[model samples]
Target: MPVAVGPYGQAQPSCFDRVKMGFMMGFAVGMAAGAMFGTFSCLRIGMRGRELMGGVGKTMMQSGGTFGTFMAIGMGIRC
Candidate 1:
Protein backbone atom coordinates (compact mmCIF):
# COMPACT_ATOMS: atom_id res chain seq x y z
CA MET A 1 0.00 0.00 0.00
CA PRO A 2 1.15 3.49 -0.84
CA VAL A 3 1.61 6.05 1.86
CA ALA A 4 -1.48 8.15 2.42
CA VAL A 5 -0.44 11.74 2.94
CA GLY A 6 -3.16 13.62 4.80
CA PRO A 7 -3.42 17.41 5.20
CA TYR A 8 0.20 18.30 6.05
CA GLY A 9 2.63 15.59 4.85
CA GLN A 10 1.65 13.22 7.67
CA ALA A 11 0.51 9.75 6.75
CA GLN A 12 -2.96 8.86 8.04
CA PRO A 13 -4.46 5.42 8.41
CA SER A 14 -7.81 4.72 6.84
CA CYS A 15 -10.82 3.37 8.74
CA PHE A 16 -10.04 -0.15 7.62
CA ASP A 17 -6.54 0.25 8.96
CA ARG A 18 -7.91 1.23 12.36
CA VAL A 19 -10.25 -1.77 12.33
CA LYS A 20 -7.44 -4.11 11.40
CA MET A 21 -5.29 -2.73 14.19
CA GLY A 22 -8.12 -3.29 16.64
CA PHE A 23 -8.57 -6.87 15.46
CA MET A 24 -4.86 -7.63 15.85
CA MET A 25 -4.76 -6.25 19.40
CA GLY A 26 -7.89 -8.14 20.40
CA PHE A 27 -6.62 -11.35 18.78
CA ALA A 28 -3.38 -11.19 20.75
CA VAL A 29 -5.21 -10.73 24.05
CA GLY A 30 -7.78 -13.41 23.23
CA MET A 31 -5.10 -15.93 22.26
CA ALA A 32 -3.38 -15.48 25.61
CA ALA A 33 -6.62 -15.98 27.53
CA GLY A 34 -7.59 -18.95 25.40
CA ALA A 35 -4.22 -20.65 25.88
CA MET A 36 -4.46 -20.33 29.65
CA PHE A 37 -8.04 -21.57 29.92
CA GLY A 38 -7.74 -24.20 27.25
CA THR A 39 -4.70 -25.74 28.86
CA PHE A 40 -6.44 -26.06 32.19
CA SER A 41 -9.61 -27.37 30.63
CA CYS A 42 -7.77 -29.95 28.56
CA LEU A 43 -5.76 -31.10 31.52
CA ARG A 44 -8.82 -31.39 33.73
CA ILE A 45 -10.42 -33.57 31.08
CA GLY A 46 -7.32 -35.84 31.09
CA MET A 47 -6.13 -34.96 27.63
CA ARG A 48 -2.45 -35.75 27.04
CA GLY A 49 0.28 -35.19 24.44
CA ARG A 50 -0.90 -34.33 20.93
CA GLU A 51 -4.55 -34.38 21.97
CA LEU A 52 -3.89 -31.69 24.54
CA MET A 53 -2.02 -29.53 22.06
CA GLY A 54 -4.76 -29.87 19.47
CA GLY A 55 -7.46 -28.91 21.96
CA VAL A 56 -5.52 -25.87 23.07
CA GLY A 57 -4.82 -24.74 19.52
CA LYS A 58 -8.43 -25.11 18.44
CA THR A 59 -9.67 -23.14 21.41
CA MET A 60 -7.08 -20.45 20.84
CA MET A 61 -8.02 -19.84 17.21
CA GLN A 62 -11.74 -19.83 17.91
CA SER A 63 -11.50 -17.38 20.75
CA GLY A 64 -9.05 -15.18 18.89
CA GLY A 65 -11.23 -14.95 15.81
CA THR A 66 -14.33 -14.19 17.85
CA PHE A 67 -12.63 -11.44 19.82
CA GLY A 68 -10.97 -10.01 16.71
CA THR A 69 -14.29 -9.71 14.87
CA PHE A 70 -15.95 -7.85 17.72
CA MET A 71 -13.03 -5.51 18.21
CA ALA A 72 -12.85 -4.73 14.51
CA ILE A 73 -16.54 -3.86 14.44
CA GLY A 74 -16.27 -1.63 17.47
CA MET A 75 -13.26 0.20 16.11
CA GLY A 76 -14.84 0.62 12.70
CA ILE A 77 -17.90 2.17 14.29
CA ARG A 78 -15.81 4.62 16.31
CA CYS A 79 -13.89 5.56 13.20
Candidate 2:
Protein backbone atom coordinates (compact mmCIF):
# COMPACT_ATOMS: atom_id res chain seq x y z
CA MET A 1 0.00 0.00 0.00
CA PRO A 2 1.15 3.52 -0.75
CA VAL A 3 0.35 6.58 1.32
CA ALA A 4 -1.36 9.54 -0.33
CA VAL A 5 0.05 13.05 -0.09
CA GLY A 6 -1.77 16.24 -0.77
CA PRO A 7 -0.69 18.55 -3.55
CA TYR A 8 2.15 20.83 -2.38
CA GLY A 9 1.73 19.08 0.98
CA GLN A 10 -0.80 21.68 2.01
CA ALA A 11 -4.51 21.41 2.57
CA GLN A 12 -5.53 25.07 2.62
CA PRO A 13 -4.11 28.55 2.81
CA SER A 14 -4.38 30.75 5.91
CA CYS A 15 -6.63 33.80 6.04
CA PHE A 16 -3.76 36.22 5.76
CA ASP A 17 -2.36 34.32 2.78
CA ARG A 18 -5.75 34.35 1.10
CA VAL A 19 -6.11 38.07 1.68
CA LYS A 20 -2.66 38.76 0.23
CA MET A 21 -3.45 36.65 -2.80
CA GLY A 22 -6.69 38.54 -3.36
CA PHE A 23 -4.90 41.87 -3.10
CA MET A 24 -2.30 40.74 -5.64
CA MET A 25 -5.03 39.59 -8.02
CA GLY A 26 -6.74 42.96 -7.73
CA PHE A 27 -3.45 44.75 -8.37
CA ALA A 28 -2.82 42.70 -11.50
CA VAL A 29 -6.28 43.48 -12.87
CA GLY A 30 -5.86 47.17 -12.13
CA MET A 31 -2.46 47.18 -13.85
CA ALA A 32 -3.91 45.64 -17.00
CA ALA A 33 -6.68 48.20 -17.14
CA GLY A 34 -4.22 51.04 -16.58
CA ALA A 35 -1.95 49.74 -19.35
CA MET A 36 -4.82 49.54 -21.81
CA PHE A 37 -5.95 53.06 -20.96
CA GLY A 38 -2.43 54.43 -21.23
CA THR A 39 -1.85 52.80 -24.59
CA PHE A 40 -5.07 54.15 -26.03
CA SER A 41 -4.47 57.63 -24.68
CA CYS A 42 -0.91 57.69 -26.00
CA LEU A 43 -2.06 56.47 -29.40
CA ARG A 44 -4.73 59.16 -29.55
CA ILE A 45 -2.02 61.74 -28.91
CA GLY A 46 0.20 60.23 -31.63
CA MET A 47 2.85 58.71 -29.38
CA ARG A 48 5.20 56.05 -30.79
CA GLY A 49 6.68 52.87 -29.31
CA ARG A 50 9.04 54.23 -26.66
CA GLU A 51 6.65 56.94 -25.45
CA LEU A 52 3.72 54.55 -25.44
CA MET A 53 5.66 51.95 -23.48
CA GLY A 54 6.75 54.52 -20.95
CA GLY A 55 3.23 55.84 -20.49
CA VAL A 56 1.87 52.32 -20.03
CA GLY A 57 4.50 51.42 -17.46
CA LYS A 58 3.90 54.58 -15.45
CA THR A 59 0.12 54.16 -15.48
CA MET A 60 0.36 50.52 -14.47
CA MET A 61 2.53 51.26 -11.46
CA GLN A 62 0.30 54.09 -10.31
CA SER A 63 -2.89 52.11 -10.66
CA GLY A 64 -1.44 49.01 -9.07
CA GLY A 65 -0.26 50.98 -6.05
CA THR A 66 -3.63 52.66 -5.65
CA PHE A 67 -5.47 49.35 -5.92
CA GLY A 68 -3.21 47.58 -3.43
CA THR A 69 -3.60 50.35 -0.89
CA PHE A 70 -7.37 50.37 -1.10
CA MET A 71 -7.50 46.59 -0.96
CA ALA A 72 -5.40 46.55 2.20
CA ILE A 73 -7.61 49.18 3.82
CA GLY A 74 -10.80 47.33 2.96
CA MET A 75 -9.40 44.08 4.30
CA GLY A 76 -8.34 45.81 7.45
CA ILE A 77 -11.80 47.24 7.95
CA ARG A 78 -13.41 43.86 7.39
CA CYS A 79 -11.17 42.11 9.84
Best of the candidates, lDDT? 1
RMSD of 1: 3.4
Report the C-alpha lDDT of model 1 over 12-46, residue by residue, as the tens digit: 88898999999999999889989999999999999
Q: What tens-digit string does per-residue lDDT give for candidate 2 at 1-79?
A: 3444578775565557656876887788779888888788888999898888998899898888778767766765665
Worst 10 residues of 2 by lDDT: 1-10
Question: Which residue runs of candidate 1 sit more than 4 Å off their true CA positions?
Answer: 1-9
- Report, for every candidate in turn, its global Cα lDDT versus the true structure: 0.93, 0.77
Prediction RMSDs, each to the true structure: 3.4, 6.5
Model 1, CA-based lDDT: 0.93
| Model 2 ranges with Cα > 4 A deviation | 1-19
The 10 consecutive residues of candidate 1 with the worst lDDT sum are 1-10
